[model samples]
Target chain A: MSATPTPSPAHAPDAAPHADGTSALLHAEGLHKTYGSTPALAGADFSIRAGEVVAVMGPSGSGKSTLLHCLAGIVPPDSGRVLYRGRDLSALSDAQRSALRRGDFGFVFQFGQLVPELTCLENAALPVRLAGAGRKQAEAQARQWLERLEVDDIRHHRPGQVSGGQGQRVAVARALAARPSVVFADEPTGALDSLNGERVMQLLTEAARDSGAAVVLVTHEARVAAYSDREIVVRDGKARDMSAMAGVA
Target chain B: MSISHTLLGLLETGPRHGYDLKRAFDERFGHDRPLHYGQVYSTMSRLLKNGLVEVDGIEAGGGPERKRYAITDAGITDVEEWLATPEKPEPYLQSTLYTKLVLALLTDRDASSLLDTQRSEHLRLMRELTRRKTHGDLADQLICDHALFHLEADLRWLETAAARLDKLAKEVRR
Candidate 1:
């Protein structure tokens, strides 16, 4: 009754890199997470160097999002170590982790998540302001990012007033405005049409690269994943890196 | 990509020399694979023999004589028929990948890994096309989009096949 195919050289475990992730900006080892008897992540290992865009790809509920949360320190893994620049996330205090997330990390979700009451410029400047910068200085930084994302004209408009594409660009501007070292984007283009999606990805990746920010992109779409430098495919709570397997034919 | 038909259709716009025809085709349809001079001349000669085009005039150029071609009435009808006729859809029911998968399963090889490798290769090409599309002109975008869609369709099929691999392996083994 064994339906499993025999392992070949292409499937050799050695093809993947060691989980220690010595030089990675963000690294996770043997991560395990569960919620109410449902296992979200069994044992996933991941790593991303500075300025590298890595895609996390899997089917629905395949622990890709869980891996991202753990990597970003939003959700602590039950029994694993997530290290950011040699500092373990689990060892950090709540306030310290929050500071790290705000100061060193940026985020973009499927929905732009721009505050309805705030104008786009205000929304983009929120991160800079959170870091205790003055209002004028924060808005100036946000203004530069908005112009780079090509949504500066709509800076005064509220999130509800702009098109989906423009709103997403504004979201991107917000993410990059803070000058974070890493950007965690979960389905950043999922809500836009093809043309819009392409534009968003182009801007997001280009801005991230220009600023030397690593991107942990989580997506199920191959087209979206194409923007990444490489991909990690998560299935049944385990993660597999596909970059090493590129040599296979 | 019927070159003769395309050449004839281009001639419909107006009389054009062999050199002009090549430039037109390359500008419009030849983003990746431009028409060689030999190909253009050969296609034009074929069309002329078929009475779809006639030599309107000849220009004595510095290098050689350039014959200007104009589409005949029959050429217009041909172009019209080509435009109206729907191209046959490629089913690819017996694709090489399917054969390779079945063979891998029959030989007790790692079919799952094979699928993953293929998926990676497909995505690699897709990434290249996406990069080109990002920096290319409108025509380049359109052409890349067509390829990207087809590759996406193939990827979708690959995912489905991966999910059903065990069932397929069982069936094929039985």
Candidate 2:
């Protein structure tokens, strides 16, 4: 799972609208974080609207992953605000944040990360099962997603029994089965071949669109970023909007 | 442009009449604009002459007798070679955009505005393709991705050209 909400101090206020009168389903403002001497994020601002797919791209060690962690509340920022629907994420108790992530957020990573022993169907249903859905209800939802992703025939197979591409599809089915409000994908297709990579990206973005869930995709590949509605590039520990400079030098 | 060779490849699957060939080709690769009947027949005739294809059968029809075509062994070799060969990457050594920028500078025109206009055009197309990708199927999304990549390169070129405009203008006038 990409989401593991970190505990933070409570009683934080709701995040106000951005100075430019902009609002979004998710927002981050002046986020600053450092790890010892090396800084990860240096006053980065980001936002995403409903049903929009945003890509976070950068060179290695440029803090793209950290930005994602901050936005998802997997880690708390040194000094900033992460707001989910105007509610300050920092304001929520640890349990509340964890529950919120479980209920409304989904994640997929570069590695398929399917438990080797669990059948594909069982893996897909894990998120729902964790959320306290009945075993039958969870498996039913998982089966529907698997069929939609065209991997229903392999439902009974263990993760190792499936090919790398098929495993990623299972991961996607799992991430989307819960119908989360947002999906955070970190190089979700990095390990697959080109054909399979394209297929996975297509399914991920299309599924997000169909579910009306916003996506925050972190990837270094321009081809992958091309699928996004907007892109933010992290450079030297700062994140900036690269949508306008997409074709620039 | 490679329609003739593509038809030979298709024929390798099995013998097919011109109508069948056209439909198969359209379904696979010509979703945008299908081959015309005349083009298909003409291509078949040329392939027949070249010995890459042969008449497998003929059926009488209302307008004209339909000759089903089959690929020869030679046709299979040709297709294999074509498939193995890498396509020539279009480096665009002397691109039209480069020519336009130089011409603007040579004629003492506002090269900066030219670059700006081109940049905006590229951005416009990128935005349009982005919208299309959002709503398109897998095939449509792939097609848009291809176009978007080329346009992205053009956009990068436009920016570099804009940055060097002053230096280019000086060199051109000198």
Give lDDT tens digits, candidate 2, residues A23-142: 577888899999998999997877787678888866678899999999988999999998887778888999989987877788888994798889999999998899889999999888
The digit string of per-residue lDDT tens for model 1 on A37-58 reads 9999998776778778898988
Task: Assess the local accuracy of residue A163 in candidate 2 as a C-alpha lDDT between 0 and 100.
Answer: 89
Best-fitting candidate, measured by TM-score?
1
Clashes of each: 0, 0
> Residue A221, candidate 1: how far off, in angstroms?
1.0
| Residue lDDT tens for model 1, B1-174 | 898888888999999999999999999998879999999888888888999999998877632228989999999999999999999998788798889999999998999999999888888888889889888999898998899998888888888888889999999899
lDDT at A62, model 1: 90
Local distance difference test values of all predictions, in order: 0.86, 0.80
Runs in model 2 lying further than 4 Å from the true structure: A1-23, A243-249, B1-89, B92-174
Identify the candidate with maximal lDDT. 1
**Proportion of true contacts reproduced by candidate 2:** 0.03
Candidate 2: how many backbone clashes? 0
Candidate 1 runs further than 4 Å off: A1-21, A247-249, B61-65
